[model samples]
Target chain A: MSALSLHGIRKDYGEARAVDDITLDFPDGQLTALLGPSGCGKTTLLRMIAGLEVPTAGTVTVGGRDITRVPAHKRKFGMVFQSFALFPHLTVRDNVAYALTIAGTARGEAAARADTLLDLVQLTGFGDRRIGQLSGGQKQRVAIARALAQEPEVFLLDEPMSALDAKLREEMQVELRLLQQRLGITTIVVTHDQREAMTMADRIIVMSKGRVEQAGTPQEIYHWPATGFVAGFIGRANFMDGVAQDGRIMVGGVALSLPRPAQFLTGSAVQLVCRPEGIRLGAGLAEVNSIEGRVTFVRDLGPVRDIYLETRLGRLVAEQSADQSRVLAVGDRVHLSLPPDALRLYPGLPVTLPATALAAE
Target chain B: MTVAAQIGPMAEVPPALRWGAVVNLLLWAIALLLCLVPFGLVLLISFGHKVEGAGWDWAFSSENYLRFFVGANWPAETTSLYLGQLYWSMRYAVVAAVLAVVTALPFTYLMTRQSRRAQARWLVFLLATLSLSEVFIVMGWDIILSNNSGLPMLFAASGVTDWLKDTGWFDVLRDWGLANPRNVKFKTSEFATVLTLSYLVWPYAVILLYPALSRLDPSLAEAARTMGARPWTVARTVILPAVRLPLMGTTLLLFVFLLGAYVAITVFADPSQHTTAVSIYENVRGSTLNAPFGAAQSVVLLVAAGAFLVLGQRLSRKSQGGA
Candidate 1:
């Protein structure tokens, strides 16, 4: 049985539908990230699976048992909130043992269990300390220990690393992922940070406007985005509005040949999406499919260098690892390559053309 | 009368005192004299003796304290009557304050969870009720709980009293001093006094607990729920523990406020069950012309109230320091 399965779950807050007909299955013993921007309802979807929210339409099943109407308490799914939410009054031990103590376990057993769970999160001797005494990372570890005390069937976290500073966030992400994998508990995380999702999630579901645009592995999401929103949201994409024709696509007045003919009819409007890294750069007029352009700017991000160009088609960015031999300065005329395999086609509309598309070279 | 936190260890006049040094010194001298006058009078009166056919005479005497503690003729005669009144004052204050705080806690939590606009509306309502005169609240409860009208009348009119009588539950009500032989009654009873006193401080309890409960981080309780706690468990393990200090502090505050309750006890308590407040009122202004004895009782009440306040402060400090 899948660890948790949500079937056509829909949640509507009055006239507005916060989560629109989301059907997702979290595989056993793997962490999945519901990745989206703000107001995308990724957090709402996670809350529903945790039973904190009641779906307007459809059922939630965990371990093959229908738990659609089960209240949050009975579902017993442990969750870590974005804020860490450590109880201020209780010591770390009492907070971790709360679930067990409230379940009517003996105090000794509950405290012992709490100590072991704290140890699992690498906060053993720190149990005697109050929550306010700990640093942000330690508090986050305490939250994790408290949530994991129940040994829940599915673990849920909502932007759990957002409380940490930029440096610590990346470190905790890998540590948390390793812990999740070792415990082998199915987990779901909701986050807007794409890098964190890509780092921790075995599968990533990209959502926008309360609907899932695409759900797949991080590589699939980054490399083969199924929609224009996914293509734009997952990473930086250079998009060109064009028309599909016989064995080629025409963007503005420039006709580019594809690897094969598109299923889209000729003259049909489409969008051509490609990652910045896939486009190669070299001197003027070096190869086929090379577009003549001037290097308007160059952004050197340490190991990777991005060369911005302005061409007839439009402004576009090409990222290449900084090389010891080849150096392209600003205003240098160059030819940029758009490999056919690296390109994706989408239906063009106003919303899909994000600010990144219109960003100047 | 006492100003809390008025004095600290380190004190030096700052440049913020806009009035020049002489003017500031004069102002402080006047303020200090004015604030000390009433307390000085109370102390002086407590050591003075009432003179027959005259007003009073200043003299050094332990007579007033002895009378307040035991009775006027203590060496030759024994009487515990006045001490019993003081005991009831403490008893009623403790029970009413605790009841008020315990009930106000959940109500305040729910009130805090409301949106800011709703919270503002609630604050207006609570403040309005909180600032209302104690005499008016006593009047309202008196009307509601009096035997001739209100709850008793409603009970009889709705057949509840008859039902209780038929079910043999009237005996229980009678045992609780909440009913008479003919019908249910509340006047001149401990129940009435306690109920009225709790109602008097109920709004105060909410007001005292408001800032603490309102400023409470709700994310903590929601987080506990996410950890698989039931509603009751969340309340017990998360909510209750979080508000313990506020709860104790509010109770102590209400207790001090109720220590000097005047209207409720006078109206509801039996003559034999009258409290120290009644004795103070009698000696100060009513039938008894023993001003010194009344001052002595007032001093005792003040000491009790101050002691409780200091204890509450120490407890709150310990809790916050530990955290």
Candidate 2:
């Protein structure tokens, strides 16, 4: 029943606004990720929810009860910091038992609960180890166990896997997600890595410049970005800036038709984005929305090959599956088509085009 | 076979190693001559006998040590006069050192939380204060604690003394020996002695504690708070435990530094409550002219300080192990 919700949360640091007015709802028993680049206010938003930072103007409610003015210690919302902030003086057992012990739980009962949690995190027999004796991954596991010892209604993690290596990070992401679902505790994770968000989040909130640009399920956001910024940030998107005309976008004298006409008035600046995998290159493709292109470079990524092309519209990259029979090398001529359904159009010119696109022009 | 071949080139010492050895030898020589030599001379002089109305002579005797523990005329009359001075010395140093550390800790913790620029400014100000000689600081306090021109006068002029009398707290102050019939007094009192001693070591305690406290992760406290501990609990459970070693270390250093403090005690403390340091000064260079007794007193003080330091080290180690 502890569904956390924020209304009009804003934070200002003297003359600068670190977090803008924004409202969001985190449903019960769901995991949401606040995904953004550095300085995107995602961490600030998480801290505000944890009651560590007071919002300039907002109400933070849990299960319809406003806890806006409550201090962090009284909120009962457990948070894991980016640095894993484990107390060096305490052993792993003492660390995990801290919340219960502080609340006057008997020593034996707290120790038993800590043992169970250590086993849950697969860190059994590590209770006696000092913090300095553990590796980075082990320390993060201890931090997670300690945070969950309170059985908080809302569990917050700020870049929980950031200190881990690539392989370990991926493994821990799945492990953490499974644990969260089993516990069915409402959770919110703040991370800058897009893959990390996509891997573990039930819903992803993409933020930029202190404002949420879009919030939806990962698939919805990835396949249908709401803005040019979201499209560029979420996944690899080949962007082409153009002017909207009668039912089409004109880019470098080429009219690329959309599945449906854009809602913008004619002569308005617009940007079209297509995923690299959406660009079809072959001998026979529909003439409409197709352009003749020359392969400029080839990149092999073990599972897929990326082919860079110079087209009349601009420079573009196309992803080719490894199993594809035909292989395109540099200087090869091909016809690439932008499927009308795959091209997402947004009003306004892109702030900056790709360097390759600029060079091609 | 390869290991053997590799070890062949390492059999001979390189020129750099040779030069480093020479420098190490030179440093040891300097340390022996500068530190150990004087310490050996002090120990040697402690056992020597004093000549009548003259300087000390080089002859082994335990008479000075006996005189310190008992009296100069042991068979007929015995008094623990020097032992009492030693007790006062220990009492003042221990109390003053603990007081300084207890107060400096919170101030240092707050300073560390300030911005880097502010912290730097505060550190510079503390270091600047360190340049004030002990004599100057004692003189300043002497004036502030004097009855005619200082706090006693201020208390009389501001009517706080009369207010205390009205509230009957002035009788309590008189019972504590803090006031006379007229107004509050501080001169030649234990209160003034400890206050000035604590003040003299307060800056040193802050400086010694700054590095450990500034490096303490603020997140430790925040983490404790998130775990449902209140601010006071966080300070007790987390912050204090994290800096326990440094706190003990700082206290011990200030204790040793205060053991020999002469100027503050001489100015603020009553003549009957003077420390072993003052006794040593009187015996050696003041009117008594008994250098052997002075050297014996110095040795006793040094031994006491060493024993306490070792005990403190052991306690800190045990606490660390327990943690």
Candidate 3:
């Protein structure tokens, strides 16, 4: 119902800082995702907001009311844990109505409200079953219903879809987004899945190393990642370490230009990022960013074909629509153009992505 | 078809599986020899008659069983002395077991919350304590509870007994038979007996409750808390219900184990309030030398314990069904 804001929040566990000094405001009735990799402190931030964890330093306020000292029980923030955490001893109805019953609502009224919430989650007639009888997705629904039973001002979910199968995760993502929209509650979801964040969050806060890397709309984050880490983390990017020379990046003795001139001191280390789709194959030789290369490998994924190129820019990847008239194959000679508008340039060297990152895609 | 065809795939079973079957049969044989055979002998002996002056005779007489319920004189007289001892046994076991579990529940929960290494250390320490013989523990408690040397002397030395008298609390203790006219007396009372029995089984209670409490997902309680339940409410509504079965099971197991407790009962309880186990020992191996009656008492005790176990199991099952 109201905006939630955190100011200068920092969490320290002995010598290690889990969440550093960070400030952000969650807009009322909008879904914001705290997106990051494993151990990136996104969950820690979410727990602080939920009042399940107290920040070692800083203040949490809801609509200008400081609640940093409040315990989770008093805050009444409905939270869905990664494991769902449904009470196995209770029936589905009781699980869903937990908040209401615990808060002293009449038994019949709480049961009625639980059934209504279950119906909202498309789990009608499942009230009599035990928690152990429900499937993973059903249990998640029960958890969501239980958290929402009190109509909490803030809704928090930590990796809510991580427990579901791949196919079910997508379905529940859309369903949960719709439910959040219908309720119009200020919701914060912490997840590592970029696609999940892009699909559901109105604004995504990308985090790394206990700090916020970038906070913006998903489109903005994808199109204009502020750092090489964000560029590599948000989506697949072909990274090339180079030196900024006169508003351009020189990688492996070849120069790449950006739409806007790179604002870095000349001869300083820089990283050039270009989405695979941003590279165009078979560009005219006279084009500004054109380079000739041999196709090292070809991957045809039905809708698109990713063509890996051995170029002066150090192993560039270009994605072409599958329906194109000319299909490039391995060992084919191709002229690729790194579109100046699509190339994103950031100061410093490119991040070294884990080798398993490629397989995860 | 040849005999090989008749034997077929069964003969092709893996060697490991065959060895497992052999081991299982050996286990069953050992169980029958070590458990069932002795029980069968006791039951058989229980039905025999006890000789007046010497050892028992193997005769098909129901007098020993009748004497357990009523006096041997039957129509001429009736007494419930043995039955009273059985009652004391049941009462002490139930009370002590309940006490042990009640006290251990909080300790075990707190212990489980500790770091894994700390929990392991505590468990190892408890298991080491279990190695202490019952006689040793009883002797230790006996010295501690002795009037001249231990708690009573401390009470007198510290002026606590005088303080109790000044505050008029000494009369309350006297009314409860926990104090004489002058000072507190713990010996020859149900309080000492129950306390010692509960202490004897306390470590077992913690060990029994450890797995259930440790395996409990902490997030369940956290979820309850976030749902507006206070800490106490969370414990009552979530933790207690989740471990209800384990708690009941631990209590019942301790109850059954304490049923035949010999040393603690003999040392702490008054002679008039002695349990069935003490009486059985007295009849068989002590001054009475009545082996048949002892065997009869043993059978009755075993049946009583088994009946209570079955009853507890059924009650837990019914509660589970209701939940």
Candidate 4:
């Protein structure tokens, strides 16, 4: 059963629609990530769910009760902002106990609850410290503890890790995921970082141009993207313009077969995407789906090597493990393989190769 | 430990640095002379005795201070008139400062929520009003509060005075000293005095509070709301505590400013309720020709202002330390 659902939510700011016809369900006790680039309406959608922004149309139901017009304070949905938004005026303990204190809880009980929450977030002894005294990661932990102190039915976070350093961000993602699971509260996190979303979310909803491009499990979003934008956004993918012709995608006179036959008319314009890791680079044994190319540049990222290749089809990047025995360098001739199972075809205007790839060529 | 080692870096010091130090010392000397000499003269005169005639001679005496605490005719005839004036000074200043700040707090908070352009426009308007001379403001209020043509006449013309009489509020207003036998009168009343004083400082209160309230992190309030705090609760928990120091500091500064107010009190307050500022004016150049006594009263007012300011600072500091 869904714990919270937004039915055909729309928000219009003047003539511009910030969130256009978004309908989604958050499964009970599951963490759903609203993933998008900046200004893609992910934050707006989250605000609408929190009752901070009223939708121009549609209803918001939680556990089958319509709460479309409920105010934010009455909704009691816990939220952590991108800046953490910790109260600098209050001590850590007071900040964490704020919701309880304002809700008319006894002082002694609220203090005890704050201490317990501090312990949960691994900051038990730092309760008396001011917000300014904590490190970025510690502040984020305090924000999480404060939000959860209310024991809200639904928890929301908007880009909670954007303010932290990259190393601390990854650690917090795992830590927050563990905490959310232990509590079993429904959660929605809005973030533009794909790795952060994939690391913490049970399901990821990809948004673009104020619309939901795709919504699925993280694995599904990664391994099987339903659109070119999703394939490019979730992870790195090399794109090539092509035409669907007779059960194959034709790219610059090369007919690349797919695991499944093309589902478009013969002359339909199409775009094909191949993940860099899925492309193999070496002196190949099979001629099927093999292309001759010259290595233009090599980027050695400790565990893997990214080989930039210029071929008749277009500029492509192939990722290979560093442990592979074949050593390739710039200006070296190579054979690149586009495995049928890894190729994804979408019907759309053909996407040009990225400038970085072309510059290397 | 040779002289060369001492002068090692100094030998390379630029000419601009040398000139800068000399200029800085000169500026400090001029500032001290300009700012401190007048106050030093006032202190000196405060201790001097007034002569018999219109002119006074300098002579060390503690009579002025003694006269301020008790009456000039000490044990024979005692009165608390000067002390009472000082008390009214503090009372009116305290109330007006607090009233202006309490009202300006919400107005400033709302103003900060506007766009930068709008905030600038408001600042321009506030500053224009703030720079209006005190004499002009007092004259304006004097007319508006006069019984013959202003609020009292308007009330009579609008039948509000008659309504008050019919509702038995006329007797209550009379008891409060707000009305005479015929109709409502505001001149020479504490209400008129406080109202004009509050209006005098209202713009200043807004200007002083704008920066702190504007820089407040709005996300903190939103975060409070999401955690089940209503708008008022958010303000109490998040906004108020964050700007507490600025609020106290602004109130203290406004209070000090009001302590020096002269024209408004003279124009609006009853003779018995007039403040030290009015007495200072009277003894110096008004009816009484006692410069030394006026200087003494000025010193007392300065001391009172200083004491209150220090007390306010200690309070703000104590609250911050406790937090």
Report lDDT per candidate.
Answer: 0.85, 0.91, 0.91, 0.91
lDDT of 3 by residue, B19-81 (tens): 999999999999889998989888888888877886888987788889999978887899999
Query: What is the Cα-based TM-score of model 4?
Result: 0.95
Clashing pairs in 3: none
What are the RMSD figures for all models against the true structure? 5.6, 2.7, 2.4, 2.5
Q: Candidate 2 lDDT (Cα, whole model)?
A: 0.91
Model 3: runs farther than 4 Å from truth? A354-360, B1-27
Give me the displacement of residue A274 in model 2, in angstroms: 1.2
What is the CAPRI rating of model 3's predicted complex?
A: high
Which residue pairs of candidate 1 clash?
A: none
TM-score for all models, in order of appearance = 0.93, 0.95, 0.95, 0.95
Give per-residue CA lDDT, model 1, range A240-281, as digits (tens). Answer: 888888858887677776666777888788888888888878
All models, DockQ values?
0.52, 0.77, 0.83, 0.78
Better by DockQ, candidate 4 or 2: 4
Q: Residue B266 of model 4: what lDDT?
A: 91
- What interface RMSD does candidate 4 have? 0.8
Specify the highest-DockQ model's number: 3
lDDT score, candidate 1, position B225: 78
